[model samples]
Target: MTLALPPLVDHHCHGVLRRSPDADTFTSHLTESDAPAAPGTSFFDTQLGFAVRRWCPPLLGLDPHCPPERYLERRRELGADEATRRLLRASGTGTYLVDTGLPGDLTGPAELAELGGGEAHAIVRLESLAERTADASHGPEAFVEVLDHAVAAATRTAAGFKSIAAYRYGLGLDPEPPTAAEVHAAAARWLDGRTPGERLTDPVLLRHLLWSAVRTGLPLQLHTGFGDPDLRLDRCDPLLLTDFVRAVAPYGCPLVLLHGYPYHRHAAYLANVFTHVYADVGLALSHTGARAEAVLAEALELTPFGKLLYSSDAFGLPELYVVGARVFEEALTRLLDAWTASGAWSGPDGERVAHLLAAGNARRLYGLGPDPS
Candidate 1:
């Protein structure tokens, strides 16, 4: 039987390209690797490519499982604007919480909402806010005052805040909040030495960004488990964040761990133990594609149903929107349907849980209400 879930709440995702991409340009964005593809092999041979061909082609007016070349040809036929609209509409997303942190000439929340026919909200990236704040400040003391005010202002109306300290200093840094002196000295040193518009990599400023975000009482989405090559995989473990989790508990903010492929189980364990902690199997589902069922099952093993949120983590390609949705719809239906078949879960329970994974849980977590429909 089918899951028949609600309109999905894509709690984390990025915008699609402004212009249609050539086949090679599109294939290149399919992996987390920064280096060129291994000799003759392609990122397209993976689950991500297969899923995109199988699910996204019909939206561009071709049959499922079409050749990559044919799919690209059809996508180009429809033009970029129409192709994006068709794909986003086909993804069944009801609301989007977009991260505009990554520098790209891509759509913002408002443009995404218009193209997709859904509600859209912003998630302020703490690191981006800090780097921008630093660009305007002359010294350490000025940086502190400006960043503090920026974090407060950014989170006031946003769904929440996000961080990539996992990419910068790694998650293994000291968990406690740093002193004002440490923040000032660190900011001064980094700013004085660097040229303008560099990325935020200073550990002290990262800690300050995190703690300041926690104080806002907004949900904090932390990238964990896996990402681009800049991250040290061993250091990205959610277990490394235990002290930091304890430190932020008093602030009454929710911690949402994003990605979590190899470490998804560890993220589940954190969610099971902490009241304010939650885990999102976003990029994992899209990256694993056809093999996503086992991964989804692993994510659900130790996670409370209410704490498991849905997201696409799709970037650059419109095909990712459909692939992310299809993988989720298929995997979730199979998992819960099997449980109900064995009498481990009731039919109604399965339906309710599937709904929570789709939209209900996110609604409660981010405080989004009933579907506008």
Candidate 2:
């Protein structure tokens, strides 16, 4: 089916530096070295270089020796290239909502803008407290400092700034998870009196942030469901967001649920019931399973057309955009075909579904001016 809609948007991702030539060589060497080796030793060796090992056991013999900074450096190296663009085109994406994990210098934004052909909606990540303290314990003050730098950097960048608070679950450098109270306290300090709700992250800090961001008329994106396997599936449940949604309802901040995963149904339910909550059917539909079509159909059953949006959450692999787009199209096709056979939607209705899933909903949610025909 031909997709006539705005480009797909990936709402969440880490724009950390890509692997350097040396790092690349190292990885290649490791791969080659372990190719004929025993599986246990190979796995252990690779695990040592991953950040996830902070929470879970390393795979094989790979030690989690590489620091988060190294990871970021590698991401930077990979993010700037034609490879990502090729992936986007292959995946049928025109617009990308690029999220640079942590706020740094305008280096990434400037580079992305150039690569995106001068047009890109960049959701710059401001204040990644979890990443900053991943390797060491930090006081609330340290969190504040990171926020300050992020805010200042955002003010300087041409790209739009979206605050990403707390890396709750097990995503940070610290061995322990951050508490709701700690998240709120740190947010309060960083926000300093500015509007709050315009950023994305955990729900614990939503009320204040939403209230603040709403005052400025900016929308907020909430990361829901699963992404990192290190996090408990229970913590990623969208159902737990009931109170968080209620608290922000009156504020009128547009709440975008990023990566609504295992709880795609519940995420859709919230989008269906709440005017403020919008479900982004991106990562889950792309990465999880071949049953993404079925899952998306279920989500749409509960979600209103206007409350749905598309995103890729493309990171790690630039080809992810293309991969995600292909999956989205495949899933969407299966859904429409089934709906048509079931008499829920006719041929014409299927076309409308195509338009809605492709671009209509995102346009409405982001309030992007009249369709860019």
Candidate 3:
């Protein structure tokens, strides 16, 4: 019995490449690792690499699990636009909540929506907004005024907000909203020594950006668990965010923890305990491939159905979207099927819960409308 999930509301993702990528560039997007694969082992030797070769080829007019070289050759032949179109359309995602934070030669929300044959909404990255604000404002005081106004303005259009505080100053930082004095001093110090286009990394300023977004009452997505080398994995655990999660609870802002792999269970535990907390195995599921079922099982252990949302976290590659969706749906179907077969869950309950994970949870959390047809 298939799960027959609804079209997904991909609640957290990023845009695909704007131009055709060379082999190395394309493979780079497949893993969280920033470095190239070891000389003998290809990035294609990984689970995500295998998953893409398996799931994406059939969509691109080839047999499943074709050689990586063949897949790239065919992709080049089809061209980026055509390849991206075929893959995104086959993904079965109806709506995209795109993070417009990462800098690259990538599509914007509107272009991605059109290419994927779905509607798209923006999830403004708070740090990006603050950094841009800092770039324009000379004084600490003016920076505060400008950033506050920017956050308020973003709330009117963006579906949510995302913060990479985990990448900057670990999630272990003091969670309480920083006082204005601290914010001003931090801003002054940062701007004084900052080079052009320097990222926002100060702990105090990160707290301020977070609090400002919280004040907007938008659902805030926080990056947790695995990422590039910039992150300290020891510090990326969601448990480290307990104080901040608890502090943000009163403001009624939904905290969506993204890419919680090794820590997905902890994230689920947070969702179970906190009314405003939500979690997704976005980047994890895509990267883990065949092992996504184990990840999903762990995520489901403590999370309520309504608190688990669907997301691809696919960045710079449409194939990631294809593999992400396929792995998630397959993993979820197998999990629910086994449970229902064992009489642990009723058939109707299993169906309903699958739908919740696919789209319902995200719709409610983000206050989105019905999924696209």
The prediction achieving the highest lDDT against the true structure is 3
- Which candidate, 1 or 3, has the higher lDDT? 3
lDDT of 2 by residue, 1-373 (tens): 4435455444444342243233433333222132444643432244212312231112112234445445435444544454444333445555555676644332253454454443456564433423343223255555445544544454343233344332343122222224656675755554454333333344434333333344344456666666553345666666666776776676676777777667888889888888888887677765543667776887788988767777766555443444456667777887777778889788887887677777676666655544554
Find the 10 residues in a row with the least total lDDT in model 2: 51-60
Each model's TM-score? Answer: 0.98, 0.65, 0.99
For model 3, residues 69-161, the per-residue Cα lDDT tens digits are: 999999999999999999999999999999999898889999999999988999999998888888899788999999888999998899999
Q: On residues 126-203, what C-alpha lDDT tens digit does candidate 1 reach at each position?
A: 988888887888888888998898888886679999999999989987888899889888988888877778998888
lDDT of each: 0.90, 0.53, 0.91
Show where candidate 1 strays beyond 4 Å.
none
Q: Give me the runs in candidate 2 sitting further than 4 Å from their true place.
A: 1-3, 11-82, 102-110, 116-118, 129-166, 169-211
Flag clash pairs in model 3.
none
Candidate 2 lDDT at 2 equals 45
